[model samples]
Target: MMPGRNLRKPAPPAAPAEREVAVECALQLRRIGDKWDLRQRILNFLAKLFFPET
Candidate 1:
């Protein structure tokens, strides 16, 4: 069986004064199935290996 993928919908940029509300909206998305469980260290290693910014 194939792995189940979670799709995240992108939200439009919020007004400059509504930063807290924008973050709350993103957290709500994580409570749904839009968040992944990958470890940060792994992602950091992969980024250093594949994306060395000169």
Candidate 2:
């Protein structure tokens, strides 16, 4: 599962300004997801090393 995946789809914006806002929001969410993914992977790797049986 990816972080911020729910932000992938938002209600359609009607106005031009709304569209811009939506785009910006999506970009920011994507960046957040990238950071989360890196951290999550690191944690998972550590967990696997500490608990190999799981």
Model 1 lDDT on a 0 to 1 scale: 0.74
Return the clash pairs for model 1, or none. Answer: none
Residue 45 of model 1: what lDDT? 81
lDDT by residue (1-54, candidate 2, tens digit) is 788676567867589988899999999999999999999999999999999999
Q: Which 10-residue window in model 1 sums to the lowest lDDT?
A: 32-41
TM-score attained by model 1: 0.31
Query: Mind giving the per-residue lDDT tens digits that candidate 1 earns over 1-54?
Result: 357977778899878769988888888888664334346567788999999992
lDDT of each: 0.74, 0.93
- Candidate 1 regions exceeding 4 Å error are 1-17, 34-54
RMSD to the true structure for each prediction, in A, is 14.8, 12.2
TM-score of 2: 0.59
Cα misplacement distance, residue 6 of candidate 1 (Å):
36
